[model samples]
Target: MRPIVVTTMLSLDGVMDSPGGGEHPRAGWTFKEVPFEEAAYEIKGREQEEAGSMLLGRVSHDEFAPVWPTMPEFEQYNAMPKYVVSSTLEGSEWNNTHVLRSLDDVAALKDSDEPGSIIVHGSATLAQGLATAGLVDRYHLLVFPLLLGTGKRLFSTDTPTGGITGLSVLESETYANGVQKLVLDVVR
Candidate 1:
């Protein structure tokens, strides 16, 4: 089975929303000021290429579809197959994108002829659902500097992560600006 990775930009306080720009409360900790000199963009791009498809939440898809389609540099991403997990969204305006209602869509992806790793980006809600269904294979966390004491967090609640264990740190790179790129795998 292809690897499933969760790629998210997290603040020091583990908050993942509005770090750079979003409608959510940014708490004056927007990430544009934090220079990511660690080749973060390059790394993410490489990973995206290897991804068989991208899984996203409705909110993220709504926010991303408009801007990502216009950026020529992100053409590859725009062309890639995308799976948007949403119960409300009926159709997608973007290319090579599909709207999924249940976890069965993701299950189909795992059994289909699709190749390469499947990366889930900026979908905390979908991530939670995938986590519950045991869909995620690994987590690629990019921990940035600066913390938002009170904001939208990835792991907002104090719930057990399905007894996650056998955590072996894979790769770590500290940026010149103090951000840390960490790759972790689940040994199962």
Candidate 2:
């Protein structure tokens, strides 16, 4: 089975909302609040190199589809298979994009013979659903040092009833800018 890896940016408080500027008042809090360190973002390049495909929720797809295609750093993802889970999205102008209607579709994809990781980025709602359904195999979190008291969070009340535990840390690092990179495997 292909591993579904959830990769996300988070504040110390766990808010996963608007790491990249958006409609939220705390939009762009990641770069705005924390200092930048090139080394802290090295994982992004490695993720692109190792990813077999990409998965996203409708909101994240809408937010990234237009912008990522134009950025040199995101060029590799433009050609990769991108599955967007949405019932309302009719189509996408993004290259190699597919729309999935339900979590069942996601499960089927994970069951496929696809190699490498199915990387999930910036899709908090979809990430939560995947976790609740016990579909995620691993997580890549770049945690900033600050806290956003009010915003969408990654580990919230919606998590699995007992809450997530048994995470095996695969890799971890703290950058000079105080940004932390945590690569954890969700132990089954």
The model with the greatest lDDT is 2
| Model 2 C-alpha lDDT per residue in residues 29-139, reported as the tens digit of each score | 878878889999999999998899999999999999889999998888888999999999999999999999999999999999987789998888899898888888888
lDDT of 1 at 122: 80
Worst 10 contiguous positions by lDDT, candidate 2: 156-165
Could you say which candidate leads in TM-score?
A: 2
List candidate 2 stretches off by more than 4 Å: 161-164
Every model's TM-score: 0.89, 0.96
Clashing pairs in 2: none
After best superposition, candidate 1 residue 82: deviation in angstroms? Answer: 0.6
lDDT of the structure predicted as candidate 2: 0.89
Q: Which portions of model 1 miss their true places by more than 4 Å?
A: 27-30
Candidate 2 C-alpha error for residue 110, in Å: 0.4
Counted clashes in each candidate structure: 1, 0
Model 2 residue 115 lDDT? 75
